[model samples]
Target: MHRLELDGITKQYPAVRANDGVSLRVKPGEIHAVLGENGAGKSTLMKVIYGAVQPDAGTIRWNGSPVTVRSPAEARALGISMVYQHFSLFDTLTAAENVWLGLDKAMKLPEVTRRITEVAHTYGLDVDPQRPVHTLSVGERQRVEIVRALLTDPQLLILDEPTSVLTPQAVDKLFVTLRQLAERGTSILYISHKLDEIRSLCHHCTVLRGGKVTGEVDPTQESNASLSRLMIGAEPPQLQHGTRPAGDVVLAVKGLSLAREDQFGVDLKDIGFDVRAGEIVGVAGVSGNGQQELMAALSGEDTRSPAGSIRLFGRDIAHHGARKRRHEGLHFVPEERLGRGAVPTLSLAQNTLLTRTEAVSRAGWIPSGRVTALADTIIRRFNVKAGGPGAAAKSLSGGNLQKFIVGREIDADPKLLVVSQPTWGVDVGAAALIRGELLKLRDAGCALLVVSEELDELFEISDRLIVIAQGRVSPSIPVAEATIEKIGEWMSGLWAPRETA
Candidate 1:
């Protein structure tokens, strides 16, 4: 008998039919995957099963019996737990505190900490229990979410884009944990856009598109091409990759060191690197190892560095604010898309003003028309799916918003572009387009500094690579010479930091 089942589920939002008659079933101890492109109703259906969103019409079954899950608490009580794509963690709370809050059973703080430690060690999810959520990196934050859901001790678990921010090693560890859970009679509902992951980790797959299930198959026996056809109805785009020689240094960091802004954060120690025009430089690391701190320093979000620490085209702009950095042709696309890269409450056109200022009046007034025109251009050129220029940034799906923020920055034609997780939750086509655009910029003699946890992506476009671990960077190496084994070792801080210019 199926452990969990959804029949004829439908959910409607103000502007979109998020889910329509979506049906799926998960057997006991099975790892089932839901695959689709962005805004294709996968997340919505997961939310429905989790009881975070009420379905307009549907019947859910738990253990062969009909049920109505009205809230997350109710779902949890009925042996269901979920880890959302966008984490629902409190920034000020510690990792253990966050997990304790989610769990239903009463337990002391020390006991919860012990359990967290045990689970983390067993699953290869290393996280400090006392660290605040705000101080953790994107991948670390994801670990917190996973640990929290695991502590719930549910019979059915749903994970949405769980590995989006994980390193390759971390992803492999997660697969092991999921398989173990399934072997112990815990059913898992995995939702991700990564076909390779589903093929390797899931026992069954259900494809969603336009708020409906388009296809279902045993992903293990299916090819990537067949899955792509069922999900997006087309082949994925190919990247035009070619060699681009490094030019004069566009962004240089020397003796860059800074204390953590928060108590739980890692302090950067003598971080130094340089990216040149016509080349892509990639930073690889396990998350929470000062990736956020380093990005903050380079993006001008944290201006604690000395005047001579960071040089943009040989100019001392280390202490400049974000606006000053952008004005100097140093554009940044932050890792967090919702509030940092783009404002959630503002329309896409209005959000463009965060970095673009040419449409601004001399006295600090913004012409909405110019902003709209710019947004329209990005939407057209990048194939961003949105409800025109007036759509609120939060209204779009994660991938679409990612495309917009990336397209916005790329359209500006900056001399130095610092982007983190450039294609976090994007579909195959969108990811290819974004990478192609970055390469185009490189071919046009522009410098790009990319910070990503996905080693494949780094190897694909980066001309040189550096690894960050425990707040320090290893010696830079040519991409042609870097191997996955060596980079994985460096991710553990096993490699010593070396000077580079």
Candidate 2:
């Protein structure tokens, strides 16, 4: 008997039919991949299977028996566990506390904490159980979620964009853990936009498009091009990266040092770099190694740096606020999409006010029509799949929200742009789009500082690369002279004496 089966699953929303007559089957010890673009019904179908959302029409069978899972708790009771794309964790709760809530009541908190440590060590995921969810970086929080689900020992495990924020090394470790679980007879339903990952890690693949299943095949036998065609109906557009001499420095940071805001946070120590006009500089690092603190300092969120530390166009803006800095033409795209990038409950058009003030008059009155028109332009330009500008930021898929947030800042035409994880959860096509837009900005004499854990992305677009490790910055190297092996070494805080000289 198959481990899990779904037939004719259909879900309808006010503005879109999220899933339409979708069907899937997973066998014992199978690692099945669900491949699709943003808003292609992959997440909706997964939610239906995990009982977070009830399908309008469908029949679900578990081990040859028909079942009705009415809630997430019921799904867990039936051996189904899901790690959502947007985390379900509470900000105030510690990692162990959050994990304990999902487990049986009979288990004690201390026992849960101990098991968390054991599982984390065994899987090499490196999760700290006592830290609050709000204190963790995106990648660190991802580790906690994965550990919590692994502790359940469920028959069916569903992971949604699990490695979207993780480093390449961490991704390899996670794949090892997943392979072990599958070998032990756990059926895993994996969802990711990374074509290469699906082709290598998954046994079977199911492709979805326009809320319907388009094809199913053995992923090992398929090429990346074939999988991309199946998911988006075409190959992703190629990015054009031309060489150009960098102009005068637009952003100069020197002797930037700040203490940790909380006990769980990393301190920024003597962080310094320069972003020049017509050049793209990339910052590569592991999560929680002070990237957040550095970004906060650079973006004016944390104005604790000393005077003369941060200079924009030769003006000292070390103590400037976000709004003041933004007014000076420094735009930012934060990594946390729902909370920092856009308010979860705010309409897309209304969220534009967070960064773009053109729709508002000098007297502080917002024009609704202009705001909606601006948002519509971004949506159309970026190809964001949503229920129009009226939809709440939380209503769209993770990738779609990312596109909107990134597009919002890019549309502002800033002299300097600071973006973090530009394509964290986006599909290949959308990733290409965002990258191309960044390159275009560079070609237009705009300075760009991109911070990402994806080395491949950094290598592809950056003219010069710098590594951040343990709250310190490494010497910059031209991308043409850099290799993955050298970058990997620098990520561990190792820099040669010659480079320092």
**Model 1 per-residue lDDT tens digits across residues 1-501:** 999889999999888899989999999999999988899998888888888888999899999999988888898899899998888999989999999887756788899999999988877887899988877777788888888889888899999878866667778888988999999999999987778899999999999989999999999999988898898898787777787567899999999999988787888999888899999999998788898889899988899998799999999999999889999999999889998889899999999888888878899877778889998998899888899999999999999999999999999999999999999878776787899999999999989999888788899889999999889998999988888988888888877545332
Relative to the true structure, how large is the alpha-carbon lDDT of every model?
0.89, 0.92
* CA deviation > 4 Å runs, candidate 2: none
292-362 per-residue lDDT for model 2 (tens digits): 99889989999999999999999999999999999999999998998899999999999999999978998
lDDT of 2 at 45: 92
Model 1 ranges off by over 4 Å: 496-501
Worst 10 residues of 2 by lDDT: 162-171
